[model samples]
Target: MENQQQTWIDLAIAAMDKAYVPYSNFPVGACLVSKSGKVYQGLNIENASFGLTNCAERTAFFKAISEGEQEFQYLVIAGHTPDPISPCGACRQVMVEFCEPTMPVLLVGDEGALKETTVGELLPYSFNGKDL
Candidate 1:
């Protein structure tokens, strides 16, 4: 699983080419590496409404869940920016609901940078099904 996680992160980095972010021009790619060793990739798609746009993290997570992947244990986000790219609040919420507290979220930059953090550390008070 270790090697597969790295492969998924690289795949997420490669998925950035499919980003359709014209407004912010900040293309982002994400990968949800499932516990079953499946890797799902997502590229940010923008909408004119802006509010209707979906983030790469959620897209990938939803895609995996639709495919019967209910146990995603690792996520990696990559962008062209110099700094590591983290998930947005909405994405973080989705992740909190979709994964366990110990799941790792990896942030990577265009220059092949890396920052690995557990979901528990990144989101202190994440919303879950119990929150409602």
Candidate 2:
């Protein structure tokens, strides 16, 4: 992995430590880099109502978007799973909404393994604004 990617992965891991996972005990973290070079970190925030729980990827995206950072450069998601963590379907749809098709999406696993992919690759033929 490139130095920058490693740095993002480390940030995601650090963010994971802050996750609030009382129900599933599954913690996840995400780091989003904007086109302007701003970085946003997010951790899973679980709620008593399972349906209200938010994933780390959406948290990061919401944070960046609310802060007026629209164009994203990269995204890194970290988890303690055996393999590199993949985003949930909702998160993938959000990625398709806000991220460029070719934007890099990095997944980091418990052993620090890395899997690099793109927004489009994650959800091929996704429904978007164009489909409306």
Candidate 3:
């Protein structure tokens, strides 16, 4: 598991290098691992209107879903920040929609900093279809 996480982190960093950050200058990358061992990667895209921006996590999820991937095993997020950054509430909600509550989420920062958590742990009592 550690090795896999490291590999995914590396991939996420590589993807981050390709991000388009004109405003915030904070690039983020995300890697989604499918149950079938497929990896989908994405980078954050920032637009002039910050509200129109798309986060790296959502980019990866959208790509994977578009490719017909519904089930996922784990995810890795990489950024250039000092400490590893957790996904935003929107991203967390998206995870709750698609990923299992206990699915592993590895957060990696520059210089090899890393932290691990799960969707359920990140957002307890998340709102879902059952709550509606």
Candidate 4:
């Protein structure tokens, strides 16, 4: 699976170059692989109002959903950090909307190292509307 993970890492690195981060300068990139074998990429976009910033993960998810894609297999998140970075709480919650709890999430660091995990493992008590 290293080869496949590398592919995603490459895509994410490419996407990071497209990020519009003028405020925080913290660019993040993400790529999601749909169940249909389609891949979607996203880059963090920031605004003067910090609250308006859109995370890389959500950008990918929103783009995929907008294209009528639903089912997802895994997602890769890349950042220019030494260690693999995890998604923020908001991004994790948004992922729960479209991804299965078992969906794999690969966090890639700038050193090309990877940390493999699942959405459920990241957000065990996710509120997926099952109780609502």
| Per-residue C-alpha lDDT of model 3 across residues 1-132, encoded as one tens digit per residue | 878877888889999989999898899999999999999998999988889999999999999999999899999999988898788999999999998999999998888888899989989999997888
Flag the better candidate by TM-score, 2 or 4: 2
Estimated TM-score per prediction?
0.92, 0.97, 0.96, 0.96
Q: Name the lDDT value of residue 127 in candidate 2.
A: 97
Candidate 2 on 1-132: residue-level lDDT in tens?
A: 489888888899999999999999999999999999989999999999999999999999999999999999999999999999989999999999999999999999987688999999999999999998
Count of clashes, each model = 0, 0, 0, 0
Clashing pairs for predicted structure model 3, backbone only: none
What is the lDDT for 38 in model 4?
93
lDDT of 2 at 80: 93
Rank the models by TM-score, top first.
2, 3, 4, 1
lDDT of 4 at 110: 75
Q: Model 3 residue 41 lDDT?
A: 97
- For model 1, where is the 10-residue window of minimal lDDT? 1-10
Predicted candidate 4 versus true structure: per-residue lDDT over 59-100, tens digit per residue? 999999999999999899999888998899999998888889
**Candidates 1 and 4, the one with greater TM-score:** 4
Model 3, runs deviating above 4 Å: none
Error of 3 at 45 (Å): 0.6
Structure candidate 2, residue pairs in collision = none
Ranking by lDDT: 2, 3, 4, 1
Best by the TM-score measure:
2
Sliding window of 10 residues with minimal summed lDDT for model 4: 1-10
